[model samples]
Target chain A: MKIKGKTWKFGSNVNTDDIIPARYLNTIDEKELAKHCMESLDINFSKNVKRGDIIVADENFGCGSSREHAPIAIKGCGVSAVVAKSFARIFLRNSINIGLPLIEIEQTDKIKNGDEIEIDFENGILTNLSNNQSFHFSKYPEFLQNIIKNGGLMKWTAKKYIK
Target chain B: MTITEKILANHCGQKEVVPGQFIEADVDLVLANDITGPIAIEEFEKIGAKKIFSPEKIVLVPDHFTPCKDIKSAELVKILRNFARKYGVRFYEIGKVGIEHALLPEEGLTLPGQLIIGADSHTCTYGAIGAFSTGVGSTDAAAAMISGKVWLKIPSTIRFIYYGKLNKYVGGKDLILWTIGKIGVDGALYKSMEFTGETIKTLPMDDRFTMCNMAIEAGAKNGIIEPDEITFSYFKNTLNNNIQNLKSDSDAKYEKTIEIDVSKIQPQVSAPHLPSNAKDVGEYKNVKIDQVVIGSCTNGRLSDLKKAAEILKGKKVNSQVRCIIIPATQKIYKQAVDEGLFDIFLESGCVIGPPTCGPCLGGHMGVLGKGETAISTTNRNFIGRMGDTKSFVYLANPEVAAASAIKGEICHPEEIK
Candidate 1:
């Protein structure tokens, strides 16, 4: 699977609260959540973000709450994928379970905000279109990769257990 | 193997399990709150499962936005209530419900050697009871509800051993904040923080719960303490006689070991944005506070209320500060009222409320305004955690919060007197 998108960069330790504030936690509607994604950190986020945009950030992305709303909001906003130096454990699992792809790379300084990048999940390579440079990331374990391939844990579980 | 590993292996039906190895383990209890429950129930329905694996083992508490903050939140709770009624799941309603973390253990839902999962991050609080409990996402929780099982990767264990005795005003909140300060927020990512030592044994169950409750702030999968006599006594009346005490093996492997002397520690606080950004309370004495909240899953127990009441028995809160006290559970609220803690709070210009998570997650009740500053006993002082992004939150124990309320600034308990 390959994902191509423009980047929306964030700094380190961007917590879930920053991704989707608690005030908007009143509903489980993905559209409502998407409208407020990153609203607190960057008010222009929802208004400006386009479909197939990618969020790139430094370490500890999605820290703090275990609310899956953070990932739901990100995916609902039509963001294709998220690339960060690291992730809070629950957010990582939440994203995977929801079928939102997440990539972890060591050096993200070269990728600036608004840079067009393409990620090759099959090959574990991230290419920055603006710089014409490529970086490699470690592949997810075979089982997790399979789950991602199936779109999410829900789909995978339904296939494995329901029928 | 360590205690965490032992419990995981037992639940996974394996002879042994190593760190970083993913295994499917049978869940003893699954927890979900109002904010996460609706989504989890949706996911569970999508799986086309007729009924939950075991209705009795599923616990749902609507504490985050309880009393229905708005129409949207009310609608969300309505969905959860319908699902609970349809499936006969154990659901705690308002007034009876408290913070999920505090209510679960107090009701004996958490026990030693049990494998537990919750949709809320603070689910690690159950580890204080010697249970192998961790937080998971809503989808994971939904899967667990349907199958009574979820997949998890065994985490490496980090051993934290404390010695000596805690000084006045220093408590579990300080210890955890200090630990997080020493190790950055992500220092223990995907790791089990196995807390041990003579100091921990002497600490009350409330303190133990407080310590384990904030483990997530340090990026730990769980924070656990081996069941000792204190633990046994706490559960004696609640648990069955067949309860087993689990402990780490003498030769248990640990990725790292940290030792701290409680005698030398000071009352600490975590500044805004990150829990790892901690400092001694004395260092921030001049930081004036606009509000002081002494409740939440972190420090909303009876013992915490007693500590705060003791500090505010005669004095009143500073005119500039608004103090709010919320008990974690209804039982705790009754106990505080019976013990005259409520009177003390009222006399000290504090507002006492029901057993709701109110304001902890900035849900409702007492959210801060723009540029406002609050000193709270709740965990996580992340940006806009309790209100506006311009507002600041200082995380501390109940004692520090109560004292700060009287002075309208961050200070030690002794400073108030």
Candidate 2:
């Protein structure tokens, strides 16, 4: 599926705490998590986000703690794609394993905030509508791509193993 | 080949290994805490193994569910305790021990140059003592338990070379926080951080441990400070000399090299929401605080307590703010009590919590309310981490944390003491 949205820009090291605080981990539900997304940075993040929006951030976008809820919260909030200079290893693995699209763009600073963006995972193209710029990342492995298309590891595992 | 490749090659008996190549190695040890043990036990049952792979290699600790705050967590820990006993696993219950990572290395359970896995992500803390450790899921942990082997992709290695000694008030925690700020969080993802420098060598074993404990926060697989005389000395009493024999080769290669000057460093704090989001502790000067915490695997060691005690001796905590101190483990707890650190803490109006990861994990204790601000020694300070979604947690070293306890504001140690 393709995704289009306006980008919300953040600086380096937007950690898990910014997404879902540790105190909020008492609940395991995703819908409850979406309300706390970026609560550490923008106090009113949950109230302001639009559907199918994108997040553009600097290096190490998800760091500190291995809570998978960070990505679940972002995805539950209808964030389509996360384009960062880099991501924490566990966060990247958790995101991809859970079917949230993450792109590592080397020149992240060039893309301005609030730019209209569209990403075609099948075509490996990331388009900036405001600047008329398009970039591409390496295609994901076939196995990983299948998992993403099926929507996260739990569903993919159930589909692949249970069936 | 990169240094990470070389180290993994050496472990797997290969000359070199590429990034994508996966290989299984002989397992050395497996650790699990109460929170993750029950889940792993369920997965371990799936393999239909009648017994554990090896009892001597298994370590089960009941740290997270200490004091058994609730019925469900108590039941879970009880199940794990029974499982540990039935399987002949080494078990450490509350009042018997504290944190598994702090006690394991000191009790001779962890050795240098061994492959260790734990269900908890902070398992990377063991890498401080030179073991190649990583965190795994319950299924993965169960797989390792079933066959005594687990798969690994050789990670890239980053070399942190130091040139100078730390100045006054700067310790290993400051150095790590500074590095995290410079590299950001994801800079070392799935990489082995090999800390090498004359300055690193001079640090006390506990200080090295404090630095290594937070390596996982940087998203690293492990943090390796090459074992030296200090490392050997720390273990000499509990383990034999032969245990420290394993060492990296002299001509090891590295993918990247980062040089840090420790002498010019000062006390630092990680602002609300991120460990890598660091700024000087003095940046938020004159801001009042509602709470102060001085405990966590990152800075709950004896030295950290001693340093905090030095500042709190004959002093009292600010009447406005509440301060809580939790020792890292029972060993540290006893030593602190024996040395009268607890008296100073109590005399200063700082409350003492059980030796568990309480406020750090936000499981219980020292929780904040809406709009309340706290300076804590724990790793993360994300919004709503300590109490309410509106509450803020600021991460700092123990000295800065203790100073803030007295001032009731975010004050650095240099400013107070």
Q: Which candidate number maximizes lDDT?
A: 1
Score chain A of model 1 by TM-score against the reference chain A.
0.96
In the range A128-155, model 2's lDDT, one tens digit per residue, is 8888888887676665566567765444
- For model 1, which pairs clash? none
Q: Global lDDT of each model? A: 0.91, 0.77
Error of 1 at B157 (Å): 0.8
Give me the runs in candidate 1 sitting further than 4 Å from their true place: B237-245
After the best TM-score superposition of candidate 1, give how far the Cα of residue B139 lies from its true spot, in angstroms.
0.7
Displacement of residue A115 (Cα, Å) in model 2 is: 11
DockQ of all candidates, in order?
Answer: 0.80, 0.24
Candidate 1, A1-163: lDDT as tens digits: 7889999999998999999999889888999899999988899998899999999999989989999999999989999999999999999999988888899998889999999999998899999999999999998887687777887887777776664
lDDT of 2 by residue, B108-221 (tens): 888776788776667777777777877754444555666676557678688898769677767888888888888866667888787779898898887788777878877787
Cα-lDDT of candidate 2: 0.77
Could you estimate the TM-score for every candidate?
0.98, 0.82
Q: Residue B201 of candidate 2: its Cα lDDT? A: 86
